[model samples]
Target: MKKKILVSACLLGHKVRYDNGNVTCNDPRFLKWSEEGRFVYICPEVAGGLPTPRPDSQIRGKRVVTGAGDDVTKEYEKGAQAALKLAKDNNVALAIMKQDSPSCGSLYVYDGTFTDTKKLGEGRAVALLRQNGIKVFGEDQLDDVEKELKKINIL
Candidate 1:
């Protein structure tokens, strides 16, 4: 009877980051969610047709690009679009994405200036979901996500 919650795979220690690195954390909330089978992990960057250990991408003036002179905004957009399909297919009601990431950042993405300054930007996946009326939030807003999840009853 657990409702599905979409989470960024990297946050759960998945080796799907742009550099093929994992952001392993001992977050009790995620651990509990995983144990309860409530977490549906995803990596939009990888899913969008980018390989692991790919170029480091950033959002510059609303476009996605990498440091290696590779412009992958279209790829990121495609990936984000794909993530939405997955979310919809899974009946996901809540999402917990990584903060400040080009792929998973739901709130406060980089300003694209590459000066380590972030300016309230939305990742491709987050933007698409919100546009489709799906509730998206960052990990810091787990309370809100959990609250919404609890409001739904499955089986």
Candidate 2:
């Protein structure tokens, strides 16, 4: 049996982003994985009850806040927990998430100013997943995904 992997819903062409848009990838491997039913999709923000076209949020001093300065740390934390539950329930070992998102970003995210200045840090969901031993990757790190899969005898 193939290993199950958690993937961002937007990366699979689902319109679950804060701006109500999807960040679909056109990679053959992604397509193949989808076809093979190895991908389990989830939108952490949406799962947390946030609506699409919602305000952009960023992490500020360990709290998640919206662009308009509304505190949404509870929602972000809820979403992260939901995502982690899904991963654990599905026995998912790998996660491919959207970069720069407050919930799913695995590498870097925008600073609280939202002026496009990125900071090196993992998002809430990514950090939680990592803490629970789930390997996480950003959308831009397909090469690293392949390497990790090979290392674990899944490639």
Cα lDDT tens digits for candidate 2, 10-65: 99999999999768987888788788888998999888889998998998888999
Q: Which ten residues in a row have the lowest lDDT in candidate 1?
A: 146-155
Maximum-lDDT candidate: 2
C-alpha-based local distance difference test score of model 2: 0.89
Candidate 1 per-residue lDDT, tens place, 1-155, comes to: 34577888988888998878767646677688778887787889988899988877888876898876578998899889888888887878778888888877887888776677888878888888889987888878777765776676431
Q: What 10-residue stretch in candidate 2 is worst by lDDT? A: 21-30
Query: Where does candidate 1 clash, by residue pair?
Result: none
List ranges where model 2 is wrong by over 4 Å. none
Question: Candidate 1: TM-score?
Answer: 0.89
RMSD per model, one decimal: 2.2, 1.1
